[model samples]
Target chain A: MATEQKDETVGTGTLGKTMAVLEAVALAERPMRFTDILAVSGQPRGTLHRQLTHLVQEGLLELRADHVYLPGLRLLKLASASWARNEFRAVAAPFLEALHAQTGETVHLGVLRGREIIYLDKVESRQAVRMNSQIGNASPVYCTGVGKAALSTLDDAALEVILSGIEFRRFTPQTLVDRAALLGELEAVRRSGVAFDREEHEPGIRCVAAPVCDAARSLVAGISVTGPAYRVEQEKLEAWVPLVRQAAGGIKNELDARLGPQR
Target chain B: MATEQKDETVGTGTLGKTMAVLEAVALAERPMRFTDILAVSGQPRGTLHRQLTHLVQEGLLELRADHVYLPGLRLLKLASASWARNEFRAVAAPFLEALHAQTGETVHLGVLRGREIIYLDKVESRQAVRMNSQIGNASPVYCTGVGKAALSTLDDAALEVILSGIEFRRFTPQTLVDRAALLGELEAVRRSGVAFDREEHEPGIRCVAAPVCDAARSLVAGISVTGPAYRVEQEKLEAWVPLVRQAAGGIKNELDARLGPQR
Candidate 1:
């Protein structure tokens, strides 16, 4: 068994395995079958089945007629409540929508969670650029524009911790595999108040992103506008950078005004 | 205690209480303090506290710095996973978006869950009409457009089962309170292939809704276009009924194409 496998089973027992299996189902691009979940999760067949049964009983997962597992209605209800009150997101939505309207390109809002960045929300562009669906997907924090933008806001020590935790597996030739090079790029982002993907994560796709902060000067989230490299040319990128930064400023302003002197 | 209160406490023990308290938090429009959760849940303070603690440990709720409870990341992750696999909503998204763009009105997609209708996805209008944020909020099936549209597709036996479950508390003077009246309206909807909420749920709001059924002719979901009565006048409503039905047809076609001869 792998090193992480030992930890999932170490005294955590069924609860840990349950969570692991739930996550596998949640993270899959589609509803997962028992065999599909078994392939991704290292848990034994009997254990996984037991976990699925308990989860379904709790109204956390629904076993569909097709025998695939889907996130349950109860979970959807809770998420809807969260989405309603998600401060940064609620305030930033109109700005993101406007940006999408203005540029006719995809707009994304993501927040840092542990060492990875997870997309919290997105306004899809009619164009359907090379990027896959972004909502709820987590990506490495060293390559994507939103990731680097958030990194630009982190202090050196915090950045070091996050950078070291990343796998640094290169998805494209432009992906930064070295910590030093990534730090240098983040420095550029810090100075310019913007970050660019430069075909770092995927070919034929590029993005410009900026980090958002609250009244407390804490980096709360990042927003990006992305498009195909051919359509979003070098000069167009220069144009979009200021708009992305302005949107971050707008979100920060709304946060400050609505939150009323965050303590 | 009320009759429902006694039922919630019936043989279920702490597990039932835990779910009740968690639901109180989930249903709140904003993060709730202990007192807020207690006020709505009717659970004893001590029991509610213990349940909250256990839930926090289980990664279902996060006690925030301000001492209010919010849905935790785990819940959000699970919700996102569900959103991804919500086949009807996913397949109908482009059609809904197009309908919203063409009509310049808020479009709602909802699925029938038990006795209520739960909005699965929405294409928000720039107009910001009288509709309260609809996603995740389940509404009574007798007075709302989407609700009646879904009801129209159900067989008499299923419709009877659902109608008997409604609380029938009137929210507006126009709201349907009598089962006979609601059944008559559903009959009209069934014949017309669409339903209208003529300010029956909320004053000043009107919607034209249509049912989306799968290849099996079972009602899978509904879509509606809602606007203020002044803007979506009775005459204008006539024009929109066909459009809403067409959108429902589009969703049905998409669902059929995607599910591939649903076995």
Candidate 2:
């Protein structure tokens, strides 16, 4: 099956094209039509149709009666299996619970997924008007507490690569759309070991976040404490900063104890 | 590009074979060798190799430096994206938190995947000696409270089909190994609207479970309250049954309110 082309070349084989199609579908936040996929993936219509049909037949993609496609449960099973084996979620679960209990605010665990932050776990507060961040939700890196917390651990070069081609959309009035302002915030996050989201992603929501690291001291994910603007005042959020950082440290210690030696 | 074969008969195509390889890797629960896949899938070596190479090159399957294969992050991203859109996890998260708060026990949201129950979400209690059940962990259907809760919703024929081929190995002394005994237990579960684990899957641990159903009155998943045997005594578990059922019902209502009308 080896072609004469170099291995690193994109779209050099059927596998590469198949992967591009899957990526396009995965990145789509909703079920998409064939034309929409072609626009996103830039694949030829003939090739895209053939690959999509193959994917649908293989159970990797499911086509609705409306002729739109979405990812199937088979993929969900695989991801769930892998996340189960990873020790980070187990270590962070208790901390997430404690954060939820202490502040009576929603807590989230997020990790870097390309230029975005994908929430791995979340604990909702018992309050009447709470934020709605379900597990597996994703948000942009520049405006979210968890995203900034995780991104703060990256070196300048790595950060540049992530920031490089992304269209920085203004989510809210408080969103730091300017690259220099975001970079400044990241610097503060790196020094203080905390990040803040003051109605950046969603209006009237405030959050404080801290990064969790693996045995190698690599920033693997982040944990956050989030609440409504009226409930979580500036002083209140500042007071919870240490608590979030402590929980993140506890998670890091547990991961190191369990998986550090193995890695 | 249409072949003479019908779409259904195109199961022998390269894409079909590639998907089979990915599914086989997921089921194996560990990195697998080329021969292990061939043995499980019953595909000819040439066809298997071609598809495996395609998958590995495409980043759906990662090839270790030593040549073993495991599911990649690309597959994980796809699954997580699908999970983000799922309404079940959202509706169950709050109830899981309430159960954890009331019982000081680990609470789980699991759905039946074939003959196993795959945990979609968990709220771990903040206790020194807590029961260990991670999100995404799969447990056998006959011995787990969540499994029984879910299985109780199935009709007799569907239940029989699921129970027909399983080799029930006893994990603990209380586990039901005989098919007739398991069926008897399931009948009890159906009558009571609750399922009991009775230390069946692990020593000194017990759980009480209830089913979450869609508006169509079909079971979509189950929720469970698990803790140490001493804390969750039979009397205490009996006391918690109503609360568990209420939480399950509330979650079902939310699911129906969100997704039922659409389906």
Candidate 3:
């Protein structure tokens, strides 16, 4: 048992606070101590300890002989099992690798998280101008290629909710800040079965994206190919659209097969 | 909140019962109701609900709108993060694929789990004589190539503890059950840095494995290539020893760099 003082206040309910501590641990670059978690999560000592104890007993956290904590094997087992069953990753990894090999461009996989898009995976090209993205990195959902691909799957009500919560920030000259403009783009994405990020997230970079939907017709995730503006021109991107869409379709098909018709 | 009927006869602790419920859900292969968990875990309603509430709060489990329970995104996030950080997968995947491409044999990455060896990752070859060793599968630590590679890392006392716990059930003719004999073989493994399985766990399958050690010289994991016994004879396995060792070394170097010299 370990003890530490906590000064910062957290208001996201007891369960939410517990989740915050776990998230803090998960996001850490290394194993952490009780004090480190307290500092990062800003939760009171008593609350954090109680939650951690429960987590330890549940095997979600491992308490080493040195009293430092790390994510436990149980969490790893659960995660691996889930990932093994994930249709999206199974379908997309080979395709993404193929896309990278074919065009010498970086590939990305992402899913919506609140008003942001969380990157699930990325395959970097062996070229000099590599696209900068990392697993677990998050960016605004209204600008990135993967973001529009996912947004195109949602109904108007769900789309409205996401748009309402976001404080649209401009990253470059091409970023869409207005709700109407973004909605129009999403509509176009729905019609085209593809999405585009023409330097919307980062200047001098462009990406083409497509949606992966489960058998339930619900959007699960998105796949994108990104490269320099000079290499990935309008004509070149248009030519690759079918490939991207085919990859997404293949993933959806796999997901449906594995998950038994999704919903 | 999910609930279970308590068993007065069994003295399993609250945490243990909670783990049992989660394990039951995992083993069932689909979302389960409160009644289902109660039946499987054999815990009282009050205790089960409290445990489920805690687990759900921690994001280890999720309750559907219809009240069925399933593993949650938190599990996926933790697993993916750990897997991404795991050096064995990063280093071994390419080499394993290369081995498969060269020899048309199944390749495996395994680590010691208690007294067993669990496959962390695997790449199957296109050959018709395929083995059933899939990722997440487990085998006794004394019988398989990867198992012996991992077991060779333990000190005498730790080895004795593991040996003492084993039922020593023989799987095949080559399986080692005698403690003294196993110890001598492990000594050879430590000196030579390789382990072999001549159909010890499965008939008609032969494997050659090499130890992957971190910077601190502790065994992190093992990598093995398996093929039909007729195709992978003593002389051929001897030839493969260098390739397996080199792959293990490559993975160890990457692991050391990524995991910060390993504890």
Question: lDDT per model, in order?
Answer: 0.76, 0.76, 0.71
For model 1, how does the per-residue alpha-carbon lDDT over B108-151 read when each residue is reduced to its tens digit? 88878777788877776442221224566677788889999998
Query: Across residues A174-212, which tens digit of lDDT does each residue of candidate 1 receive?
Result: 999988899899899999999999899999999999998
Q: Model 3: clashing residue pairs?
A: B4-B44, B4-B45, B5-B43, B5-B44, B6-B43, B6-B44
Task: Return the TM-scores of chain A for each candidate in numbered order.
Answer: 0.82, 0.85, 0.71
The better candidate by lDDT, 1 or 3, is 1
Q: Candidate 2's error at A51, in angstroms?
A: 5.7
Docking class of 3: acceptable
Q: Enumerate clash totals for all models, in the order shown.
A: 0, 0, 6
Give me the chain B TM-score of candidate 2: 0.84
Please tell me which predicted candidate would have the highest DockQ against the true structure.
1
lDDT of 3 by residue, B59-162 (tens): 56767545877765556566555555544565667777766566567778887766777676777633122112154555788888888888787777777888
Model 3's DockQ?
0.23
Candidate DockQ values, in order, are 0.37, 0.25, 0.23
Chain B alone, TM-score, model 3: 0.71
lDDT of 2 at A211: 86
DockQ of 1: 0.37
Clashing pairs in 2: none
lDDT of 3 by residue, A24-51 (tens): 6765778799998877766578867877
TM-score of 3: 0.70
